[model samples]
Target: MINDGLTDSKFDQRDGIPDAQKMSRAPTVAIIDIGSNSIKLLVARSSPNNSGIEVLYTHTIETRISSGISQAHPRLSAQAIEAGTRTVTELLRLARAYQPDAVRIVATSAVRDARNGQEFTELIETQTHYRVDILDGPEEARLIARGLATDPELSTLNDYLQIDLGGGSLEVILLQKAQIQQAISLQLGAVRLSEQFLLDREAPIDQNTASAIQTHVRKTLETSIDGSLPSLPVVATGGAIVITRAILAAEDGLTIENRSACMTMQEISQLRQRIGGVPLHDRLAIPALPPARADILPTALLTIEAVLEVANADQLTHSFHNLRYGIAAELLEKR
Candidate 1:
């Protein structure tokens, strides 16, 4: 659960305003997400009926704060911390322009797994005056599941497997009857795996390295999961997945907005093969692929492919509603 202290309380102190009046009004919230690869801002207002969120703005800045995360005693580098702080400050400033009633900043796998994560958060608080919530693995998974439930299309599904892949960790959630049956976070993130297995991210991944990554992912999933994953629909959300979708859309001469949300295992495999055969510089030439993510995108695709095999699912539905949306919904509901 999100901390009570993080909830909006500005409405509680209206001198002459009645509690009912305050409760009846919609509330706007800003959520700043500090991830291993990027920092994102989402400013949204709840509908009067509290049924949906209307997004006012969204932005992202890649800060790759999880560099060196594959080390035995992983620590955030000084350069990464500085870049992260600067980006967070800028995003916070932008988020405040909408006059949000409440603002929440949360950090995921990168900060939680780092040895000096406290140092990074302290700097942000001292400079920005907003405390960052460093979520543990299970709690992060839970919040992701909560966020996914907010999607109207996804809400109709009674059972499915959800995967949220990030730079530092991969969150896996199994939903049965629209309730979470299992939620776990693994160290199978793209950045983490690239650092661990790929000697040269700038170059194309050779067959041996690709095989090694697949093997590691399969073993990790097998060890973490008690038994075989049920054959349910799979849903994925993350920067990598979004980029993959965009690339596919571009290849088919269609805009990302017009592209289908569902992706098949064969499509993913083909994309991985094509993308993995090229070096980072060559990949940057591809449309809709972000340069910052070019190096690790191959590893990300590999990870996603392995996950699908483990789940015995051939296709995955991509959801734009993620952790921030989930947090935003919570804030609005409290109001």
Candidate 2:
């Protein structure tokens, strides 16, 4: 059992890796990530050895399809169902247009949490001849860990904790010697939590709301982690953390790599508070943050803060890589 409580833990910034000068070619791989908040399709060309996949094209559709699907008596709303179907159709069309050698589609937290998850999978297979693999949280965390290790930005870090916060789930993986030791996926996510708790904020981040979210996340992670909350270097991924990092960079006049840069707890707390106070319209105006994210960012911030607290990390590193690259890497290795 990995420790999930926030500790004043720290990790080294292991940047300055020599670029791959040989420019090895990448294979063409297509992947569709059915997340709770959105569906993304990525088509990339990669190297023969599965070392890299150069992104060729991408498509994203904000479905909110998994909204409210994690509650005690949850069901996929009609709107969510239609939106998912349409999103998959669009992605399949794009895949056909790209004519890639193989297309791999994986549904993350949202679909996995939905009672009608298989129904959605069947729909995809029937309509697009594509089988959607619903990855368990631990597998999701493992693949994300692999992708992070491959990133040249953090090339020197030997022991690291990687966190990927998605719409329907949050995946945490502990890595040592560039290998994964423990991985778990908690049932807390931006969109899922937002639909349930943060869709409408009745007040600011007082002790009450913060305590509530913290307790809920702590309990959920405790269950997922078993018993122990180990101390390790921390790395973070997913849209919320990425956006939070970007916003921090913009405000602090700091220039760090989008996903590989380190972030201070002060910064994380500040962002969480600032976003929680801002009106939805103003949040939408934030550059790089889409309108789709405005509603859920508050919950996202809370979730991040909770995870950071449980992990006992005073600072964290953020990354743009997630299910898309994970799927690509898995396919390349399998091939």
Candidate 3:
């Protein structure tokens, strides 16, 4: 069984490696991740001769699954189902062109929470010839941990806490020397929080509103986890937080390579405050700020801030590599 409570997976690999582990060359693989806020495709080729995997291509679309999630029930709206299926169909077509040895599609929180999620996945499979694997909470956490572990520098920590902030949920995993000690997925997502408390209002939410959001997040984390966050190296991933790192780098006039550099809470908070004041329309003009992310950025940052308090770390390092990277690595090992 996997950490996210999944017993098994029906995924298949491309034709390069043998069960005996005697392979001359690594296989080329593709993964399509249907996330809450976005759909991403990552194509990579691994070489047994070489220790690293080469990323052939990556693409993403802001499908915004949260928008389609019916607040009243665990169902996706008609529009959402259409958009999600369409995106996956297009991605499948593209992945086929690459002729990867194997291609797999996985859906996360948005799909897992939807009452009609199975219907949506079935539609995509019928239309695109791809099975959609829905990752439960613990499974998602474990895969992320495996992916982040790809970084040699990060894998060496005496203790490491990975907090992946997705559009529909937050997966927090605590690792002791690269082994998972505890993991949990929380429903504290930017899209959900914005819909619940911050939207239908003007830009630059007042401190009062921020306080309420913070209180809600903090109390929720405390209740979910057994105790305070362990003192350890803190790492963050997911689209919004990763992009925020790049945005911060741009604001500081730093080079592109340094965008993923470590950042303190103050820097995060300052960026949050800066964007909070700018209306969505004006935010589009800001460099490195994606138009799709402008409205939800404030709440996204707020969630990170609250998570940082639990981490109790002075700074947070955002990994550009996400779950897709981890999934690929796991497949390579099986090969």
Best by TM-score: 1
Ranking by lDDT: 1, 3, 2
Candidate 2 residues 1-335, lDDT tens each?
21111111011012222235212333356778888878888876665454566667887887778767658756677677778988988886776554455677788777777788888777777766566788887777877876675566677888877888877788888787988778888778876666566535544445566667778987787777755666776888887787787776666665545333777878878777777777776677776666887777778878777777888888887766666876776665554
lDDT of 3 by residue, 1-335 (tens): 11121211222234334555523335667888999889999877774455656778889988886673427576788889999899987876677655566667899998998988999988887776566789999999998888786665565565788899987888999888668999999988887788778755446677887888888999989999977777887888898876787787888798657665687999989888988876777778888888878888888999899889877877888776778888877775655
Per-residue lDDT of model 1, residues 75-154, tens digit only:
99999889999999898778756656788889998999899999999898888777788999898888888889888877
lDDT at residue 66 of model 2 (Cα atoms): 71
Off by over 4 Å in 2: 1-26, 48-50, 195-199, 202-205, 226-228, 252-260
- lDDT, residue 48, model 2: 46
TM-score of each: 0.93, 0.83, 0.89
Deviation in Å, model 2, residue 32 alpha carbon: 0.4
| Clashes in predicted model 3 | 3
Checking candidate 3 for backbone clashes, the offending pairs are 4-138, 4-139, 74-115
Cα miss at 326, model 2 (Å)? 1.9
